[model samples]
Target: MSPQLLSLVTLWAAAALYAIAMVAWSIRLSRVADERIQARQGAGAASSTTAEAAAPAKERVAVGGGDDAAVAAMASGATSFVVDDGDETDLPRRSGADRALGAARAAMYSGLLLHLVGLIARGLDSGHVPWSNMYEYTITGSFVAVAVFGIVQARRDWTFLGAGVTGFATIALGIGLTVLYAESTGLRPALQSFWLVIHVAIAIISTGVFIVAAVATTLQLLQYERTDGERELTGGAIRRLGIRVRNGLARWTQRATWFEAIPSAQKLEAVAFRLNAVGFVLWTFTVMAGAVWAEHAWGRYWGWDPKEVWSFVIWVLYAAYLHARTTQGWLGRRSAWLSIAAFVALIMNFTVVNLFFQGLHTYA
Candidate 1:
C-alpha cells in the first residue's frame, strides 16, 4: 500500500488510543473525587458527612494522618474525603481517587505513544515537519496538547484538566482526518524556512494551552445537583458528571468555587492567565513573522490580507482581555470568556482565511 495511506491508518490508531485514555481519566477522577476535595480542605476541611455550607481552606491536606477521621467526616456533607493514601505506590497520594487517577495517567501516556507515532508517520511521509495544513495543524496541535498536559501535570496539581483538553484535541484531529484530510506533500517555497518552524510551533503549543484553559474555565460554570435541598458532591471532582446535566446557554459566567475542591480558583485563574500570556506572546511573534515573510513573498507586510487581519484581530482581542483583567476588575468568568473569544478568533483566522479569504496565506 502507499506510504500516505499507511500514515492515515496509524493516525486513526493514535486517535483510538486517545479515546481510551479519556475513559480512563473519567473513571479515575470519579474514583478519587473525595481525595481531591480533602486535599483542598486542609485547615478548613469540609466533611462530605456534614450539613454545613462550603468552606474554603488556606492550605492543602495534611500528610500521614488518621484517614478514618477525614473519611467518616465527609459521608454526610455530600462531598466525601479520603484521608489515607491508597497503596503507597506514588507521590504523597494526597487524594482518595489516586488509583483511578493513576489509571488515567497510564491512559495519557498511552495516548502520547499513539499521537507520537501518528505525527512521526505523517512527518516521514511528507519528508518535513507536518504543520503546513489544516490536517497537520489538527494532528500536531493534539499531540502538543497532551504533551503540554503531561508537562503541566508534572509541574502542578492540575492533571484533572487533561482529559477534557486532550479529548478536544482528539476531536479536532479526527475532524481533520475525516473532513479535512489530504495526501502528504512538500512545504511551499514561502513556507520552507525556519520561520515556519518557529512561528507555527509556537502557535501549536499556545493553542494546546488554550485548549486546557478553555476546558477548565468552562468547567467552572457547572452546578452541583442537590439531594434533599442540600448541595452535595454530585460526581467527585466533576460537579456535573451526568450526561443529562443542563448546560444551557446565556449563563457563560462560571464560578471558581465550583472547582474549589479540584484547584483553587486562584490557581485555575493563574493557569488560565499564564497560558493566555504565553499564547499572546507567541501570537505576537507569529503575526510579526508573518509580516516579514509577507514582505519578502508578497512585497508588503501590512497589506490587510484576510489572514493578516484575522491574526491582528486575535491579537487585539487577547490584548483587550489582558487589559480588562489588569485595568478593569475582570477576573474569573469574564477573563475566561475573553480567552474563549480569542480562541474563536484564532479558529476563524485559521479557517476563514484558508478556506474563504483566498489570500497570500491561503495555501492550506
Candidate 2:
C-alpha cells in the first residue's frame, strides 16, 4: 500500500483506540466516584451508630444533677469513632489498576508512533518540515498534546485523565486527517524563517499546555458543581452549562452513588490550579518569545496583531485566575470558575483569532 493510504489507516485506527480508552476511563472514573461516596457515607453512618450505641442510659444517679450530665458526656466520649483497619484501605489499591495504566501508556506510545508516520507521510508529500498549514498545525498540535500528557503521566498517577486526554488527542488526530487533510506542498519565502521555530514552537507548547489545563479545569468544575458551587460560580452561563453536564452525568450514572464518589472538589481544584499555573507561566513565556521574534522579523516588538492581542488576553486571563485563587478565601469553587474562564479565552485565542482576524499571527 502507498504511504498515504497507510497513514490514513493509522490515523483512523488511533482515533478508534482513543475513543475506546475514553469510554473505559469514563466508566472507571464514575465507579471510583461511587466508591468514594460510599466510603464517606459508611464512615459517617458508622460514627453515628457508634455515638448512639455509646450514649449513657438516662437513669439518674442519686448524685446531684451535675453528675448525670457528666456521666452522659463521658459515655458519649467513650464511643467516639474507633479506627477500623479496613477503613485505611480506602486510599484505593493502585496495584489492581496497574495493568490499565500500562495499557493506556502502551496505547499512547503506539498512537504516537503512528502519528509520526502520518506526519512523515505528509512531510514527504509536502517536501518540508510539515508545519506550514492548518492541517499540519492540527496534527502537530495533537502530537504535542499526547506527548505532553504521556510525559506528565509518567511522573504521577494522573491516570484518571487518561480517557479525556487520550480521547482529545485522538479526536484532534481524526479531525486533522478528515477536515484538515490536504496535499503536502513546499513552503514559500514567507514560511521559511527561523521565527517559525520560535513562534510556532511556543504556540505548540502553549496550545498543549492550555488544552491540558482546560481538561483539568473541566474536571474540577464538574466535581464542584456537584457538591458546593462556590460564590463565584454564580454566573448564569457556567452554571447553566454545569447544570446540563450534571444532569447528563446524573442520568448516565442513574445512581446517587456516582455523584458522591469521585475525587473531592478540593483535590480536583488543586490539580487544575497547579496545571493552569504551569500553563500560564509557559504562555507568558510564549508571548514574550513571540514578541521578540516579531521584533526581529517585523521590526516591532509589540503590535496589535490579532494573534498577539489574543495571546496577551490569554496570558492576562490565566494570570487573573492564579491571582484570584491565591486570595485567602478563594480556594474551591471561586478559583475553579476562573480556571474555566481562562480556557475560554484560550479557545478564542486559538480559533477566533486565527480565523477571523487577518493579522501577522494568522498561521492557523
**Per-model RMSD to reference:** 10.1, 10.4
User: What tens-digit string does per-residue lDDT give for candidate 1 at 1-364?
Assistant: 5657667877787777677777776665555554555566742554452434344333344557645456445533434455547764443544435666676777677768767877878888898888998889888988888888888888888876866876886788689899988788888898888877777887787777777767776654332211112233366545654322343221221322223335555566777788778778877887887788777776887998787788889999999988999899898667777878987887887776788877777775
Quick one: best lDDT, which candidate? 1
Backbone Cα, N, C clashes tallied per candidate: 13, 4
TM-score of 1: 0.73
Model 2, 1-364: lDDT tens digits are 7766866777777676666666655555656665566678878887878866566655433333345444554555543222324335334446423545555666667777777787777677676776677778888877777777778878976667777788888778777888777775667566677767666777777678767767776766666544543233345897878666666654544344444434566776777777777777777778888788777778889988887887788788888888877865677767777777777887777667767889876655
* Per-residue lDDT value at 201 in model 1: 82
User: How well does model 2 score by local distance difference test?
Assistant: 0.70
TM-score of each: 0.73, 0.73
